[model samples]
Target: MKLLFKSTLVLFTTALLSQAFAKTTICYKKDWNSPATIEVEKLEGGECKGELSYRDMLKNGWFLKDIKIEKGKDGLNYIYTLTDKRVVEIDNATILKNEYKKLDYRPFAIKILNVTDETATINVGNLRVGQSGIVQHYYEDNKTLIVSNAYVTSSNETASTLKFFPFTDLKQNAIPTSNRKPVTGDVIIMNYMYDSSLIIAPSQDAFSATREKYKDNNFLHSDLFAAKLKSEGIPTPPKEVIQEYAISQNLGTIFFIIDNTIYVVDSKTFAILDKDIISYNYIENKRMPFYTRVEKIEKNIFTSMLDYKSWFGFLNKIFGDDTRSEDERLLENEIAAGELTVKGEVYNNYYETMLGIKK
Candidate 1:
């Protein structure tokens, strides 16, 4: 009799708790492009009388997309639809009307659909041929850490593919073994430039296409840097431990080539500064070693951060003698010396992020 009473008491408590934590079945989509899925969301405390709010969804990085009511045997079923975000697609007419200029240079949030040994396919619909970014994974605590660098070699209207590379030291001849690889559902911050002096490609074949043009360039090659790291002792460091070390040697500007296009991205703001498409043709109606015509069409995107003078200096350094005016050199020195007043908030934010100085 005593054993029976004890068992009954335990069962009663468990039932009461279950009733108190009862949830409403809700409909949700992981992203806008995803299919609707069903989930049971916990109701608030206090006799289980509280209702779900939009604030609760926002707290979990979700937004209310729609709500529906359907008649059921239990009386009425309430289906609440939610999505990660509301994405408004850019129409072709708007793009043709120069309305793309109104869009801000915000980091694109993309989800990994599939993964492989060296690459991952993403759900991002519009990625330029040479665009790059960083892949990250969120922990249970909601904090996200960088996993690898991602580069786009090809993209279309619905899906895009990315190649992954490990984070490496800019000045060292060593590549630390990456402890993590991108898996499905990992988030990618697309077009987020990690450093200014870095030039990245998805593979050796992609890099070889533009190798002849940049033979005299002083840019850091991601593949060569990774090779150097392999030659050194393979040291696998934690993600947080490698954050500062990965960025300490950055000089500030990113250049990447995909096929015939070269893209320039500003490391400070992670914004694309320019795109140049190289066209080749035979001169004098005949193919000759000395008569091959290589022409370039430059898209001059003038911004306050990257003025024509800065662009000229960048070109000169890569193609010319790397000479800088005294004023420019002094400004750079001031920036390196932590004089925030010299370059304003843009440079200050850049330095803060570059040095991993959290606010």
Candidate 2:
């Protein structure tokens, strides 16, 4: 009995020590510059599964390159690894700070249409010619809407006003109805005015000049705009040409021009989330049932049309008639589909059916 008690006590103490000495492996990588070194420290009260703190790296101008946590083979340890080493630490905060000084003389404002318990409806105000507006901030803390001042302008209208009303009076009281939906955090809005009378031509120099002025603001002046132009199949401009034209303006909205039609981008990541293209065939004075068309031009890839209709009345109301073609009846049956195939592998039907791709 005495020997058995001693053995039990030793086992209990061993288990306690093992629990207290848990550790984990943390992996990290440096930026494009090879041989990048980083000093890491164990934070007090941190995870028993080894966790590395980069507080020192952040202070030394080193940002997070990439970090991912995974379960270890034994299931007791958590492995953290940095995947990408190309991400460089940029001084975005410094750039934004410097851009504030060169802000044009424009009083930034938003017309509060309504304020509710969970949301606020507001319209962006326009700036006068030669004046600019800035998006200082958009935040909600303790149920209060806070906006900042930022400005941009061109020689267009001398003045404009934004309307505001009580929240209870606006339509769709359940949901906020501003010009655009605000993300949960803050939705900063900036307005700019351009003189329509000015016959301005597109030029690289003009855009460059504007970019220089707002260098600190990180405004997507020309480089970003140029990419947008190409993605939409718009004609690309010369490399370094300047044009005398009114600066295009946005009312705190994403702007895109497709086939001479302008569009607004509203999401934080302004990438085309989803797109469907439809083609119509003019039949013998009468429309026929929409059929799915599939085409495989390369590899295990295929493209197809999934649906069509004579009139997309619902879409016309929101996107407006601009999306409509010249035909008297809107073609609602055209859609483009993409599919991929792998050699010696079964094709994944999941991708096609999930996005309504007929092929």
Candidate 3:
């Protein structure tokens, strides 16, 4: 019975968010004969063996997307209306073991409206985390309906408002390729991979002057950069990394801004990545977090490998002998141990000198 319970839990959760967001799907699918809630369902013997349901229409969906219920248009109980092209068939989905109040759900329509890259007309909704434990679209009042969305922290998402988008998937055609620069006070926001950083310099000399300060203490606010990124706004940003940009071993690229325009610099030549998209913003004028893409920086394996020549030069450079410091002793002990295990010509030459192995 417990096993059956577990299976049912897995069955529902797999049917909901994960299964739905896996692709663009129909929440309520109708076959030739019947109106089936599941997009695809296969019954095995007596029980329902497999099924795909209305949640399939979610395209790159979020866990708290389109599921929140506000006070209805009729102004009575709380309700959330489905838009076009998708439906949410919420039969039973297992959630994390917690005590947060979950929503009561029923099968909605197959109204899958593409939400990403959409700029909503009215500044009504704000994507916020509610007590219900999901990303919910919150409006100012009950009358205002959330018709569409683009992600942003602020409520009023006008042209001036700072918004968020995936840095990697931006529309390439929209960025301007001109060499124009913003005035000294204009703000240019950047999303490097997922991390958000803002550059607030308008001139080349000022920006270069700021960039040179990183060598001192690596502080963004110290003489180098303008200011740190605060979730609230510019200049006084909280001391934290908004998102972590993963460093690649072999791939290197730098995304930097000049005159409110971003340029992708190739690591190899440190030149503009694409001439056409040089100094560009999003086609829709949206700004993404800019990551400085370093070009192919050298990582020569021969220079890094552990060998006699390398060991000799490196040890001599660092003065790894005297055995006074803990670091020096560790290196000497490691080298001595390495020599004892080998019977080769390389080991023979260094064993006497490094380990005091007398002839």
Candidate 4:
């Protein structure tokens, strides 16, 4: 009888320890910015106690602030504060024993689309199921994302388009003539020169064609002026005021007086195209003769002329000059002239006319 009683006591102790060793639920606070403390204890048979610091507790996402473990009449009572500012207490033991692993994967694909001289559009698609956020990709070598500012459209298709503004450094290399040898007839070469300064390469075909077209298009001439006024949105000034502004900007002086309005056409295109009234006002002081600034006036006059081949060739010439000093005055002058000519012509002619100004 004594042996049986001893055997029964041992068996009971073993069973209790086994139950106490079962998995305990780990609890943790999700807040990473703040720290919290944690405590662990055995509930059933043996008395096992442990305390976890906030930093260590973070690894398991469980933070216990004020913790206590005690054996009561009911069972093992584990009590703790979460430092979450809330007073809620968790009682599950299974949460402590579970192990977690992180999962990560590349969730999208990148597709390059048409790259124009000014812009590039790329398509990004196949986002992870149900995941939504700005898609980002890092260029490892550059240590930067190839592009950001990606916007997602709600077309139910998982695709997004990203427009990339090419870095300034890449612009030169991307030019069509970057790898080509210098050729006289090459449009790129012509563009290079034309872009530098208003060096008019008088190609017979281009010059005649441009001249003839403008002469026949009377509406186009008036449209140009009207467009400028519309774009400026300021009330039309008197003829004197208009002339002064144009001359100050080196655009050219007013020539023919049409119905109280002075008509000033870009010099290069003047003979070819009808005059565009740059300003309309009563004549004031005629200190500067209209022909005094004829060169500038002529340059301004034809600045709006569009010869794609010539323009491209001009750009190539400017960029191809490796021996030119960085601070060369001539180059600077050329660039300034080119900029003024191109912008003035395009703005005054095509764009303004498009906005509707009747000749």
Candidate 5:
């Protein structure tokens, strides 16, 4: 009876804690059982606006002091500036269009629908650019897709790529040189010079079209995964114990782990994907022995740390023999240093994440 009572009390306490931390669940999914109660009010100018105020946000456990509400530059979507590391940029949100132009669409993360060698279809997202010139991949509800005729190719090992015409450009202007066909054997060389232009090398050896099954669909589903972990008594893993992490795009989850516990987050929603208690490497660090006393510093320590024995060493010695500027040499030196540092990194595949996302 005592054991039963203890368990019941623990469960009750956990329930209360969890309820206090419930967020405003804006249902972007195709189906939702209980969505957030969104209040809409009519303005004097006959416009309707959403009512996600500071008080409503605090109920979701968000520290309202860090949130700054601002209007989107496109005048369509509202910006909820958050300081936490959460990827709130990509949330599906309601749009209030104060500035609307005929066919005026804001920059957005393109929702790829189909990209075959013969045709391509995509739904452009409503993008918000921050003051720091960073593009937020979030989208408003009033997004529409555009289809263009194109060709797709596949490559081996290096990477795959998709090429399509800018629908807005094609709609506004006429271009005769836009439909240039790629060469058969060349690898696609990508160059990002501007916001609207995506440079692709015309070749089959370097790039390939995205697979058919992965196209026209949302693959990363973090929120659905988070709901699975909503039960009480879930364990929180240590942050430093995450020695390795990677975006398992094929699996639609961001994998977090090293030797013991593995956390898989939904790539789209940034929600914890694992449905069980996660354990950290509590024993790995202590498995080694410590010295009884301090040891003498060996000359090999400097040799190992500063030895550019590989190509980096050679490059560091003779970086600017050519006509390269000081800035260029410095950039190359930094790259070399980074490459050296990565050799000692505990995690190898950290860059494989979606913009190296941290949870």
Candidate 6:
């Protein structure tokens, strides 16, 4: 026999606000697919005054699902919904875990079976084509360092081939400093292979300079999307959900702006790779906009941060020879020419699929 109990926890703040009330409802099950237990928590304040905050949920694996705020004649009603969802971690990459309240995705780990010019083959059977992951190499120093990002171009039961985007070392002025390379023992880890980046700002006005600087570049903007959700009468999602949504769009970098500073963070590990500080001043008590100073910032900031460069030159220095034929140099051609296909869609060549010429 199974005994289930419903509990309500009421935490009161020191002072009440305008006679309003706030409530938090948690619906979760101890086991997957089991009957959910609803726990209701109420606070006696309009502003949702309580010591229980969002970050507190992480300890017990509870995550915010959604929230609702309603205005009442007395004051307001704050409704917070949460759930207990599992979070998956990969290579210590917290992008998924940090951004999604419930980290329910499975982690994919694969070994580098072989490495060639700008490409590496991994022993992956479940990774989908176009999925990306961080590539870490085990160095002789006993430290595993992230050397590059890899994306699956083709995969099968036997093996999955990945194209490498070697991280550039500006300090060493090398493609991947210290002569480290992806070896047979290195690992490719995927919580999910993120592709693009998400930039969060106070508003478009706050990001105007970076926007004009990278006019051709495309990235997900947080404020814009939130406003769209608001316009559609949809409540804004939790911060973690917002970032998780960005990951769904394949955004690998998640960063934000505070005042005049731009923090470029790695979406996977949430590490601040670089920071951009815009110079400005108050001219006679009126803030003066310095567009010229903004231009002085790196024009190729995004390119330098996100773009993939040819590590073939560096590979040649170590391996010494262009043994790969012209046909193999191009990844798309190689994928289409071979038995590799994404989602069971076979293509004679990449162009035929791109041009919509079905065979």
Candidate with best lDDT? 1
Off by over 4 Å in 2: 1-141, 144-161, 164-201, 213-217, 236-359
What is candidate 6's lDDT per residue for 213-303, written digit by digit as tens?
4454456655455444334332212334454456556666554544465644445334333456653331221111111111111112232
Ranking by lDDT: 1, 6, 4, 2, 3, 5
lDDT of 2 by residue, 1-359 (tens): 33543453354345334433232222332121211222343322212122444444343333332232222232211112211221211222222222122223122345433333223333432332112222223435544432322222212233333221121111121221222222323433433331111111122232233334333333433433433333432221211111111123232222222212122221221211122122222222211110112221121112112111211333354346775434423232121121211211111121112112313
User: Which residue window of length 10 is worst by lDDT in model 4?
Assistant: 188-197
lDDT of each: 0.42, 0.26, 0.25, 0.27, 0.25, 0.41
Per-candidate TM equals 0.30, 0.20, 0.19, 0.14, 0.18, 0.30
lDDT by residue for model 1 (1-359), tens: 33543453354345434433232223322112111112333333222234544345545655332333333333333334344532111122222222112222346787877787557898765554445677889889998877776666557778888776553323221112234568888998875533235554333344444455545444555544443333332111122222232355443345544334554544422334455564433121111000111111122233244443553453354345545445445544332332212222222233223223325
Q: Tens digits of per-residue lDDT for model 5 on 167-222?
A: 22122111112222222322221211111211011111111121121133232232
Q: What would the TM-score be for candidate 4 when compared with the true structure? A: 0.14
User: Residue pairs in steric clash, candidate 6?
Assistant: 86-103, 87-103, 99-240, 132-193
Write the residue-wise lDDT of candidate 4 on 1-359 in tens digits. Answer: 33543453365345434444232222222112211122222222211223453333433443332332333233333333233221112111222132222212222344333433212233334321111122233444745232211222111243433322111111121112111111211111000111111111112232233334334222222223333433443222223334334333333222333222222232211211122323223232221111111222112333334433343344344445464444332433533342222222222232223212323
Q: In model 4, state the lDDT of residue 300.
A: 36
Stretches > 4 Å off in candidate 6? 1-195, 214-217, 221-224, 231-237, 279-359
Q: Given candidate 3, what's the lDDT at residue 32?
A: 20
Measured by TM-score, the strongest candidate is 1
Each model's total of backbone clashes: 4, 27, 37, 43, 8, 4
What is the Å distance of residue 314 in model 2 from its true position? 31
Ten contiguous residues with the weakest lDDT in model 1: 284-293
RMSD of each: 22.7, 21.5, 23.6, 32.2, 24.5, 25.2
